[model samples]
Target: MMNRLFGKPKPETNALQTLDKLNETLEMLEKKEKVLLKKAGQEVEKAKEYTRSKNKRAAIQCLKRKRLYEQQVEQLGNFQLRIHDQMIMLEGAKATTETVDALRSGASAMKAMQKATNIDDVDKTMDEINEQTENMKQIQEALSTPIGAAAEFDEDELEAELEELEGAELEEQLLQPTTVLPSVPAGRQQARPIPKRTAEEEELAALQAEMAL
Candidate 1:
């Protein structure tokens, strides 16, 4: 009833809205500060003119007004500083809030995942995968084996056949004709030179030849 009477005490403003409000206030303070500074400068100029005219009282009054304007400018500067500080703190708080919210969302998602899956389901899936792998291995082994590889063979009969083939090859080689080469002459006959004989030796040779005839 109290809320109804107060017309629903307006919703709490968010960080962005608060920061925008602060910026507007800061801008207004700066504008006021500028106007005050300008007024102080004008006061100083009026004081100078009064002093030149030898009106000491008027110059003193202008100086007092200048002091007041400077004081107001200083106050505006302090207000701007407070606004900037508030904005910085609010932005920091906003960042912190966003970080917390992100962490909370991640935790909730993890909790949901945990609820959906259990250890027994994981074990069953692993078992199915292992069975499939074993079946695939068996299929591969079956395909790689040669046909009739399980049939028995007679090693002794195979050896006997190999020996028979080798014997036939040797006999065929022996049936081929042998080649013969012509014989070389022993040596060539050479003419021998007669030795020069002395006259007595020649007569003795001739006498021997006559006696032989």
Candidate 2:
């Protein structure tokens, strides 16, 4: 029983680490593909040179080497494609795992919060918030109030002061001077002076009297 329980072997590599290694291998393959392509071009040039010199066997050999290099390049391309497919699949799986884990954590936290709070507690908290809000509004209103004793003056005192001013103005008007026009007498005509007669005037008057007699 002990042998059966302990007989299983451990994994030689972690999956993520294996994927990283595979990516490196794909990169190496791409580098090899580039090198092979350069070699193929060189071989084609060699084949052309040999054909121009009429060395048919050498030309054929060069052509054969170029074909082999192309085959290896094709194989490397397939390997890179496989590595790309594996990476895409691994990345998708990793994203899905993280998403599920995040959702689970959020749900657990919400459940814990719900377990910690009751309806009565929620109502009490809301009442506290409303009380605080009202207190803040009252404080703001007090702060915004106008400064000085004007806010404290009694309405009756103000009315009394206004009446006193009006009374003082009336007394000043009564103290001013009153003017009266002079009256003239009616119905009194003045007499003019009469002239007195001289002595010559009397003699002439006597002569006339004698002639009449």
Candidate 3:
């Protein structure tokens, strides 16, 4: 029992192999304990039979043997408990070790990535991106504008030309024909009715008289 519970493994044995060995030992110990329990029960039965036959000496001896087997069974049980404790501790240690190894690998990868990309490379890349964006914006602006939309006009010259046309229109309005009356002899200078003439009709009559002359 002691040898099984405190067994030594070779240096090359890993945690998994050790755990397997522990489990095998545990199973062997359990079987042995069960056998011992069966033997103890048989011994008790024998002691009862001897008691029925009135043999006090043989009954005491059988009881003594049963007690020894029970002790052995108890010891085997303790061994199994020790194996279980060992397995639990070993499993926990394995988990902790794996976690540490994974963290180390992740840190190493991150360090390599950081070393591969320096700040200068990052800044240069960003500058290139910005330059590309600006070039694209200029191209888009050129494509979106209509052709010949940027032709320039002189505002002052347009304003002066418009004022000249307006002044000529005002002068033409002032030159429209006016109403006229014929002269009377000095002895008959009394008031008399005169027909009203529209400005357009007066101008038409003047034009006809001039054409006649």
Candidate 4:
């Protein structure tokens, strides 16, 4: 029984360590793939130069090297894909574990809540809430009512005052007199004439002067 419990422990640890190593290997493969891509480009350039120099063998060799590099890159891609699949599986497992834990916690919380409350207490609480609401409503209505005081003017008195104002207006209109203006002529306006100096005026002036002398 103890063997059954512990026999698989080392295997599990080794599996985890293998996955870690695989992750590191995948990263290294990706780096190597990038380097190989650069090398392939360089080989293409080298082939072009060799072709320009009329060296057919050297150009063909460079092309071969570029193809080999591409093959290695393809192999590296396969390795990366495998690593991605493993990571996705692990993530799914983790999410499933968290989901189960959350469900269990919720179930426990609901059980505790069920124990903490009773229907009778809920009904009593509701009754108290309704009573307070009614009391507050009554208080608001009481505060809104007018205190004891007689109105300064009743409705009939107000109507009588309005009629008096209308009568005064009518009387004032009857007392005002209507006026008429005289019509003016449309001729040229004339000013008052100055007195003329005549012989009689001269003689009177001369006689007054002789009397003074």
lDDT of 1 by residue, 1-213 (tens): 986786754323467888899999999999999999999999999999999999999999999999999999989989989999999999898888889888999999999998779888999999999999999999999998665844456678889999999999999999999998866566954557988899999999999999999
lDDT by residue for model 4 over 99-122, one digit each (tens)? 887899999999888767777888
Off by over 4 Å in 3: 1-13, 131-213
RMSD (CA, Å), candidate 3 to true, equals 18.1
Candidate 2's residue-wise lDDT over 1-213, tens digit each?
875987754332345776788888988998999999999999999999999999999999999999999999999999899999988887787678778878999999999999789788999999999999999999999999867987898889999999999999999999999888765556755455766778999899999999999
Better of 1 and 4 by lDDT: 1
* TM-score for predicted model 3 compared with the true structure: 0.57
Give the root-mean-square deviation of each candidate in angstroms.
17.3, 22.2, 18.1, 16.1
Residue pair clashes in candidate 1: none
Ranking by TM-score: 3, 1, 2, 4
Count clashing pairs, candidate 2: 0
Candidate 1: stretches off by over 4 Å: 1-13, 127-213
**TM-score to native of every candidate shown:** 0.56, 0.49, 0.57, 0.41
Better of 1 and 2 by TM-score: 1
**Model 1, global lDDT:** 0.90
Model 4 has how many clashing residue pairs?
A: 0
**Which tens-of-lDDT digit does each residue in 1-213 have in candidate 3?**
865997876333688899999999998998998899999999999999999999999999999999999999989988898999999999998888889888999999999999889889999999999999999999999897666734355668789999999999999999998878987788886777887999999999999999999
The backbone clash count of each candidate, in order, is: 0, 0, 0, 0
Lowest summed lDDT window (length 10), candidate 1: 6-15
